[model samples]
Target: MGTGVVVRALSGRYELLDPLGQGGMGVVYRAHDRELERTVAVKVLPAQMLRDADFLARFRRKARAAAGLSHPNIATVFDIGEDAQDGEPIPYLVMELVEGETLGDLLRRTPLTPAQAGQIATAVLEALEHSHGRGIVHRDIKPADIMVRFADFADFADSQARVKVMDFGIAKLMSETATRLTSTGMRIGTPAYMSPEQADGRPADARTDLYSTGCVPYEMLTGRPPFTADSPAAMRFQHIYSRPPG
Candidate 1:
């Protein structure tokens, strides 16, 4: 919350180095762990948001959903806590700092070969399968959210590319006992990669993740999303009704 060069310690363990990126819910920083002497990604939710009961509930739910899983293809959540900053408490999550570029960044430069695309899809599916088996449905699956490590591209036995899926901020817990996260008729997820049921504001399950994952390969091969529109409203309509281009 200060100048670019300002260094701050969070929870007295994570030493903030520089800001990485920001999303709707929080700001992400590339930080160092004084305890472990390693680099990590710290997603910090503003202290004010923590004061709101509804937002705080959703934020914790998201973190808990992500923290439940352990897989090579998923970013690891190391720690979570609050840090006092100028008399305010800043809640933060310490996550594995993934190396290499995002799928979106790679695609922007060049399209992937069918074989390469297939490899990436398989890795992502493995992650989905593990999460789905635990009743967690990733509501968002897009190029930007997928990290591909070129260094591991030759490790075909493990995976041609080390693909790690990030950002489960809107993932839905698909069990009857789970809390009803979204309000009635409220929509969540990115329109460009949204599953049909998600776009229609219907209940999503493992199948929802399958449909969204299908979109990844389509874009990898065609160098574009299956459908596009001028506005998010139009995209939602297309996701619900329009067939993808052949």
Candidate 2:
């Protein structure tokens, strides 16, 4: 399919408009819901991933787990279904579409002030807290996954920006069933924002997410990731051993 082609969804409830972007595990599309008369973001797994039994099973489980979570700071998952054309049983997650810039995009032009960073950080922290309470750890918590929206046009002086956390595709749930879901030596999550324990291939917990959260504010203030290296391996090493820049 072409980059921006409007493809019909598998369930036929929604029609995908065009490709918004591709992530590690899935391709996100901007789609319109005919029944609801609104726009939604759809994340569809790649064909290759669906063929992998382990990945497909875990993907469904994770999607279900994420769908059960409801929070203002977290993106709302509306529906899950397969593609109708191929009957490949591909799992696609429907999410509320927010018209705002990512934290990464905003940082490219101007670094957030300490107060601004704090505001964003607090919202993410709240999200993590809620997810953690549900026995879920957001393995990836980087600036790129954070969506920032202005509070209001009139209350500019007193308004604080709102933040919505996205992309829980790699989230690990603290349940017995999920123990064997993740593949061995298959490191997930963004390298630059990975926690030390995660970089070392250790099972992550809430603290691991907190460590990743720390990287966000650091990047917001410094205009760069806390760890830097020549390659992914070198970056992993830095994450494991080096102290963050002061």
Q: Could you give the C-alpha RMSD of every candidate to the true structure, in order shown?
A: 4.9, 4.2
Tell me each candidate's TM-score. 0.84, 0.86
Question: Pick by TM-score: which candidate is best?
Answer: 2
Error (Å) of candidate 1 at residue 19 is: 2.4
CA-lDDT, candidates in order? 0.76, 0.75
* Residue pairs that clash (backbone atoms under 3 angstroms), model 1: none
Off by over 4 Å in 1: 2-6, 46-48, 152-159, 169-189
Q: lDDT tens digits, residues 193-241, model 1?
A: 8888878889877888888899999999999999999988899899998
**Candidate 2: misplaced stretches above 4 Å?**
84-87, 151-156, 169-189
Instruction: Give the 10-residue window scoring lowest on summed lDDT in candidate 1.
Output: 173-182
Q: Give the TM-score of candidate 2.
A: 0.86
